[model samples]
Target: MIQSIKITLFDERTLSVRFGDIIIMPSAKVLKNAQYIELGSYQYWPVLVPRGIRLYTYEQVPGFLRENPYITDGYRAYLTSRLCIKSLFILSNETVNIWSHLLGFFLFFTLGVYDLLAVLTRLGASREDYVIYSISLFCFQVCMLCSVGYHLFCCHRSEKTSRRWMALDYAGISIGIIGCYVPGVFYAFYCNNNAAEICSSPKQMAVFVDPLRHSCSPPYDIHTFVWFGYCLQYWRQVYLVTVLAMMLAVFFAQIHPHYLTKKWQKLRSVIFCAVAGYGLIPTFHWIWLSGGFSSDIVQVS
Candidate 1:
């Protein structure tokens, strides 16, 4: 950004000036015919305001962060989308719900890059281990946002509008739920598809261990049996959640109104709650997040 030479107001004297982020240009003179100066790799432009342009702060922030008209529109829209989706917008209640999840998207986008880098570096990246787990997690977050958005906004319109949006919301939940396991299953068992061939019993079918590359599986005599049993129980519940969420989405979205003998308005609360609840099952993220889950942190051995 080049420094402005200052405005000639009363005495027609040029004042030397340097501005960091924002400037008020006199609109009638400089703004009407101002040309952008090209400085090497940058083109500099300034906001021209009417004489005596007064600047006000937004939300207690300083400079262009508040006064830059061009910048605020994007953040405002982001704020609008997020703020409106969560039953906040009487006109578009889904706006806040939609936006909160969208903000979450920025979070996951960072995680995705970490995933690929973890794999290439081999940083002890395991499937269930969490690096590649990001893909599934991100997918579900997006779907949940869409699902919540649809349900929240659908009610704002007419009956036909409500029906369509509700159905779309249900489908989003179904898609998200089904995708939830992909990362865990894929990352946990990606290299061990061959292990499936060595199974001896139906109980042994639970032996989908990745064996930590060079490390031996836990001693199968006792520790292995204990973990296997624990994991089997865990896996069953996890799978059941996916299945149940899917069934509820499809069945409720299509069949519930048939027998409930109530308006869709009556079912709205239950539907939104269930959809939101299914998305919450993935909250184990807090644990993985807290225990140094980062691309920079890796197991040395």
Candidate 2:
């Protein structure tokens, strides 16, 4: 006799599976989760696993032997690559990390649009100020979105692919650090020094910009300063601080594995706070040196 199976939908992304002598209710959790079955009896059926399914040891991770020595054997890992982007919405240990940044991207995006429109619609808003604000905002959004992708897709089938996502995550960190510098540097340069004279310098160059720039009439033109002139800005000091901060972050990420042991797990949160705090050092230093903070620049930066 040929054995048969039947499936019933519990919801849009969940269902119940009935085999010859067993009935299994697969939860929505199976979205990012993996499952299994008896080798010979159900060789043709899909294995529907629940999210946070089975915890995997470093050795159990194919190609992970001889690596991540610091990691202990008490963590969950997906064993298969059957699900692609669908896995992103599923709950897992990485669920918080992924959703936090994804939501943050939306927050920054909304703020960027609102602020940009506010500046352009105003009668006396400075065009340079708007450009600086937008650059900073765009950089922040890219970084956040990249983080979302990294955390969500880092569990792909190929270990090599997972490593690539890690690289992208680092790139996002670098770009975010650079973005944090743009406005802070621009404002400190023009606000504390000679704006009119610097505007006329040969360093200012015109470039293609968003349609939003047309509202200001000339589009966007950024002043690419000379090495000496650029170095003079207080934000460069901030950039240096940021570089150090990023280096520290990368060091922690590489040397200390977050998945290693429960005792060192808190390092993840510490690293995040430390990088953010380090980025603030230059801002505070500038405020002290400049005698007071420029509300406009500080607000955006």
Candidate 3:
């Protein structure tokens, strides 16, 4: 039997009612034309859904939002913060840019959780491995989120808001680069004698454990562990420090007033390219250290 019924109206002809255990909603036609629709309810508040959100042409947007002349239509501009967020659901030119990175954030976040729970645990990952994986995946998530923020809010009425998000996007890129370097450097010099020497000082016969050694035994008589006597530890530190310095330099450079301006566009590309290209230096050095291209380590890597 139906007890008491309660009804809430979102707009004309669009109402939701609850009768005991049953819920009733408005028809799809009414919902389509609803003036104020409730997306969902949070703990204490209903989520606001935008109504009659309008799209504009490239020329209709403000100068700051006119970065892409090729994209002539379907631009959302002159929107308040609330409206900017609502625009996430709307179909617009920036929708791809926004959703792609948003999805990327979730993907990396899922991978991080999986690695920590299953993959890392199965491999008997050390404290350092856990830390490295966490940092790398976290950086990736940050990068994705920053990109999503910039794309979503770039349509804000205030140019200042958009520019701040852009700066954050750049910072996120730098962080992601650092994440890549951490794991790559750690594993590349995993068995380096100099690194082992530095880590376990006064212990000449230290048994340096390589995580990869647990899986497949190498062709060396030293069991799964391979001995290396090169100064790779020095080069490893040098590469990391160099990358950090370069990232900092790039970060500070973006602080300049004209850094984001179209006038310095090519210069910005060159700067980022240089920073990324610097990795090739240590890569080639590693190949050389491992006895060039034909070596077993080089081939395996």
Model 3: per-residue Cα lDDT over 15-98, one tens digit each: 577889788986876565444322223211222233445566666679988887887777777788998888898777889999
Tell me the tens digit of each residue's lDDT in model 2 across 1-301: 3266886544334456677777777564664454422222223223554532433445555563325545544233443455535556454456788889999999999877876787466756676677667777877887898788777666666666566566568657756776777766565544324533544554531222222233232332343233223444555655655554665455446434332345756765675566567656666765544334543334444
lDDT values for all models: 0.43, 0.56, 0.70
Model 1, position 292: C-alpha lDDT score: 28
Residue 105 Cα positional deviation in candidate 2, in Å, after optimal superposition: 0.4
TM-score of each: 0.35, 0.49, 0.68
lDDT (tens digit, per residue) of candidate 1 on 1-301: 6655453223222222336545454544554433221122232223332221111223322322333443322121112223324334232223466657667656666766776576545877554456335546655665666665554444332444444555665665555655665554333322333343434444555444323211332224434534444554455456445645665565456434442235655565665566556544443432232222341212321
Worst 10 residues of 1 by lDDT: 72-81
lDDT of 2 at 198: 48
Sorting all predicted structures by lDDT, with the top scorer first, yields 3, 2, 1
For candidate 2, which ten residues in a row score worst on lDDT? 204-213
Name the weakest run of 10 consecutive residues (lDDT summed) in model 3.
Answer: 37-46
Alpha-carbon shift of residue 140 in model 2 (angstroms): 0.8
> Which has the greatest TM-score?
3
